[model samples]
Target: MAAPNDVQISIPKNDIEEQGFKDFDYSQRAQWLRAAVLGANDGLVTIASLMIGIGAVNEDARAMVLTGFAGLVAGACSMAIGEFVSVYSQLEIEVAQMKREKRVGERGEKEEEREKEQLPNPMQAAMASALAFSLGAMVPLLAAAFIVDHKVRLGVVVGAVSLALVVFGWVGAVLGGTHVVRSCARVLVGGWMAMAITFGLTKLIGSSGMQL
Candidate 1:
């Protein structure tokens, strides 16, 4: 029998679970986590899709290996360079814009005294943007490396990459408080365009009697 003066208290287990879930989501880390997942996924899809398309034309194992290897090298380097340049360019634009805005703000400080002023911090903005862009681009290329078969590998990588791009774009839009559907659509469309162009070019080169 419990004493009359004693009190019993119970805490729901779900309360902690809910709290943890909330903590794990909607943070800066969320973006990075999403980036890594999407990047790896993109790499896989891109390579896979490329390989499949190549296989459709011919079933030579040597050709497939050559194609896959070329893709791996070309894709990885392209991703790295693209990531660096895109990030660099984005940082430059952001810095330039911020500086311009800051200059204007300073010139009109007296008139805009009532409004809050945002001073441009070029260093911080550049660093953050560069880091984000590099990491985002690296994800897909890394995922493509795991595939073994040359042609099939390329095909799988392409498909995975395309899917990853859309997923990442959606994730980015959500984080930025924009339309998820539009962002995802843009990525998908862009990926398809890239695939088409690449396939077309490869076909042209092959038909031109260029030995791989």
Candidate 2:
């Protein structure tokens, strides 16, 4: 019944749909990359730092190697446990929050959908978070295992660990929807404090003729 000029117009929806799909793909890839970086960086830095501080005081190759081995086992296990606990705790809290949010969401679908939060199973989230954390804390230690000189290796580990923590903390903060500057500063400050304490203890013990 419409005139020729009033003919129905059809728009191609594929372009938009395709673009959205690509964007989602890219986002997922980016998140994976970020998690990888975090895990590797943490592993490299923490273990290295621990080795460096220990090596600084004990110059013996045997001792260094032993310490490094111990560090590797301790760090990896600690990372796994800590990450599991932390992630599990967070998952519990987030699940509770989302449950409450779900009720609110049901009350107002439009508003809730507009502010819809994605809450997955606690076990899943916890497992993922813990895995990421443990992996992050494992890299530098592994690197140190291959290095030869105890002292030099230790120093390398310290530097690498500090750098790694800074990078990981900053990146993590960004992912967590927080301020990178604050997270970075927090990590850096803690590193400096730890170094100071380690060295100070060494000095105090040396003066007292007691080896720490």
- Candidate closest to the true structure, highest TM-score: 2
Assess candidate 1 and give its lDDT: 0.57
lDDT of 2 by residue, 152-206 (tens): 6666656766776788777766665458889887776776676567656665666
- C-alpha root-mean-square deviation, each candidate: 8.8, 7.3
- How high is the CA lDDT of each candidate model? 0.57, 0.59
Candidate 1, 19-84: lDDT as tens digits: 876676455444344434444434444554465456545555555545655655565555545554
Question: On a 0 to 1 TM-score scale, where does candidate 2 land against the true structure?
Answer: 0.54
Which sections of candidate 1 miss by over 4 Å? 1-116, 119-129
Residue 115 CA displacement from its true place in model 2, Å? 12
- Report the lDDT of model 2 for residue 151: 57
Per lDDT, the best of the predicted structures is 2
